[model samples]
Target: MKRYLATSAALALASGSAMASGLDRTGQPIGIIFEEGTYAEFSVATSSVDLSGNDRATTTVGSPGNPFQSATGDVGDRFNMFGAGYKRDINEQLSFAVIFDQPWGVDVNYPVGSSLLLGGTTAVADSNAITALLRYRFNENFSVHGGIRYQEIDGEINLAGGAYASIPGGTYNIRVDKDGAFGWVAGVAYEIPEIALRAALTYSSEITHNFTTFESYTAGGAATTTETKTPQSVNLDFQTGIAADTLLFANVRWAEHSVTDLIPENFGGRDLIDLDDSFTYTLGVGRKFNENWSGSLAVIYADVDGDNLVSPLAPTHGYEAIRLGVQYTQDKMKISAGIRYTRLGDAIAAPGGAVGVANFRDNDAVSFGLKVGYSF
Candidate 1:
């Protein structure tokens, strides 16, 4: 019950409102439009796990027909997100905006006495992001923007002896602590007056972190130690207007989740895992029914290629989503409400991956917001 509540809170923080263009605009009213604003804050969150091929009991059998049936375990949890930002108009052609939010994070735990407990994998990742941006409006028909970002990340992991009992000798353990780093980004936008079309492309740079930990490589039940570093990642976001009242947005995120293979520093060198890049796409349309009422609907697809390569550590895959929202504007104040539904696709594992890990079926979410606009 506690875990379910946590997952719900996290989803609420990260759920995006329908038809929101950018977080930096708050001027002229269009229709039932949800223009970008600090809204006093924003957030993103998810707390769930995969139990597909993680069965530990029959791991030694390793058969092609049912290699994943060994994992027989379940994972679930709860989390929350919160942040605040502000934007300013520097002039008619230039503007400035700053934002703070959590873009990447994970938290999971495998209890004692579980069959899949080999290597006792337990991990927690917490992070925060701060960004500064500058925008230039060339004319009513076009504009461009770019920025720099700073990220702070930290994590801890402990692998107990029973954790990797599936491996030959059946006894191994390790502990790790990770450090943070910095990153950057740049982007541009173009607008067409005749069709009221607007488009934007933004790129986020990579960030690296150093990790130090202890390893108990009990060959005959012995011990050891070492230090390591995990590489960062890159992300890209693109958005465009299909018509006067429709918008399309998509994002691609690539990361080196393989950094988990390096284990304790004494294992000679880093053993990089091969986690594939992920993608998410969104499409939405807004209609102005008059001056006081407006509404929108959107759909998004998320694909995280962590199937066979994934573990009890963090399970991810393809999913589909739908969203609906309505906005009311009176004078300079706007009220918005929205709802979303997400579904985790079926499982498809590769050779040598965990088995019987639970498939994250579905989730529903709703959001309410108010924005006050003033133009000088």
Candidate 2:
């Protein structure tokens, strides 16, 4: 049952992408603390996205609205994520784990020298985090875990096109130096080992970053400081054994992204990225075919609430996805592989919170993941 549960989790993690609720990538999982004995694992995932859109006739000025601009030509770029963790049991009742993961990111680039409204616009963001956690078992049925996370983030953005004509040359750029901050995590779990049932609730506090920023435009450039907060989130993970060699699992996650505002002083206090709060739900089933093989399938969904207006830097809203995974175990070594496909909701790119300037539809992405684990 435990092996099946682990396979389900790996499949779900493989499906994670930047298109998730807000800027989520890895889902900040801490399941290593629950592993039996000493365990170690490493995992990696790569995602390729196909996202493009067309400029609206309304974007062009002083002409009949007949000839609209060409397509944006796959603005979404390919990205990869890596994670590793080591867990050790201190005693019968206490355990600790150290984990590393790339938690959040974004990479977008429009073709240069194109007729599209947002041609030549680009944005790249990166983040890395390390977490140390301790878990203590109160009895066979209850346990608690808490941790501290140290994270660093950095990014740069370039805006182009007539939409940004307010700038000196219809272009603007900003680069933010990497910054580091600390946050905390806490969670509790209840389990009934006989039936393989467990429920865990986790809370992750927000981390604030203060970055030294350089802003430039056709008119001038300036060096300034900016502050931004990553969203706080809550996760509920539940699982149970449904029948012999079969398990059921589900998860619910919420992120408060409305408060994660990036308003640089040099940018006239306009929030560069505006995101709404989000909720993500997942359900899956796992089956063990034999002693050494298992497989799982899962579905993920998030609602857009009928709002399609979005930032050009991070376009798209809501999502629906399907994930499939297979695992092999022999002795103390285990290997897992999974794949996911996501359909991104349509969106209208609105710069500076204004009316729509472009439409993005029929976009999607594919992701692949592999994980290796060893227990001693």
Candidate 3:
């Protein structure tokens, strides 16, 4: 009787499989694909952040600092994606499925030297991707999977020396252009029918980004260029259903931004300014009120500390966020929407802290998404 009771409890804990769909900061989903099905999905999201007014002048420079310099601005961005997939049944005890999706990235603009340009442009780090996955089911309760990823990344860095539409001239422009690189991922999962519970563990391998940049000289002459590659990252997620109407999920991710050592290859590396590794964590609960609707709330934290800071013009430090999401499903179709409020951390003053430099602070965003899936 005691053994049977213990087994029953364990099954209960595994009934409602908890799933971690996306990261709170980058706002990327985690789940892969539906079982033995084909579907199409689309999503659109947006965000806004405001900076704090801390004197950006360095004490070492002995320069009179300008107070009340605000880095607050509008950073609205969006994403568009479309994918189709299928799941195949091998036998009663074995099955296979394939899925495709677009992963992570960011595109943002800030005031150049406290002055907003008509473009209000400063720097841009852009990224995009396409992923294909295959999964095998061992039985009614267990399975494993793996996949490949191809990605494209590029960016531009504009320093406070030249003039563009709204800001002063003399700023520096470091332009980065890249093609693509390949990566991989693998994971396992288990399901318990007795209590409607399930659990899964997934590992996403890092994909390297190789590219080139042209450095614009403030003095004169044409642009000088160089080549380099950005580092990779690892993501892990675990989810479970704790109640008939409630599910819990958590995720952890590690990113090596330090791998990015130079902008324009000809300029060489910046020893005094290099980025370090970063770790992010997320936890949330999903509640299903009825058969057709559900809602979720999650909190996230990131520790972006570095003994060596990169991009003297940008920000350094970890961030935190609170995210809320809701989903509606009706006969082969599901729609999801989410909003997040973020608090960017603080950074130490560097050589470029003078002029209108300010500590980074912005964590406001609003997002909406729609996905339609069909089972075979």
Identify the leading candidate in terms of TM-score.
2
Q: Candidate 1: what lDDT? A: 0.44
Candidate 3 or 2, higher TM-score: 2
Ranking by TM-score: 2, 3, 1
Per-residue lDDT over 1-376 for candidate 1, one digit per residue giving the tens place of the 0 to 100 score: 2111111112222344311111100101111111232223333323333332344333344543544533423433344444545566666777777767655444545555453433255566555677777777888656666677776655554444333444445543454444556666666666554544445555555555555555555563323333333333443433344544444444444444344344444443424122444455556555545566656666766556555344444544545667665655565444444555545454432212534333333322233333232222
Q: Count backbone overlaps in model 1.
A: 30
Give residue 126's lDDT in candidate 2 (0 to 100).
93
Candidate of highest lDDT: 2
Counted clashes in each candidate structure? 30, 0, 22
lDDT tens readout by residue for model 3, 121-142 = 3555555665666667777578
Superposed by TM-score, candidate 3 places the C-alpha of residue 70 at a distance from the truth, in angstroms, of 6.9
**Residue 323 displacement in candidate 2 (angstroms):** 0.3
Q: What is the C-alpha RMSD of each candidate to the true structure, in Å?
A: 8.6, 1.5, 7.1
Tens digit of lDDT per residue, candidate 2, span 1-376? 6656666665556445536755678778887788888999999889999989887766353365656666778899999998999999999999999999988888889887653578888889999999999999999899999999999999999999766767778888999999999999999999988767889999999999999999998879999999999989898999899999888989888888787788988777788888878888889898889988888898899764438888888788888888888888899988888889989888888887677777899999899898888998
The ten-residue window of minimal lDDT in model 1 covers: 22-31
Model 2 CA lDDT for position 196:
76
User: What local lDDT does model 2 show for residue 98?
Assistant: 96
lDDT of each: 0.44, 0.84, 0.48
Clashes of 2: 0
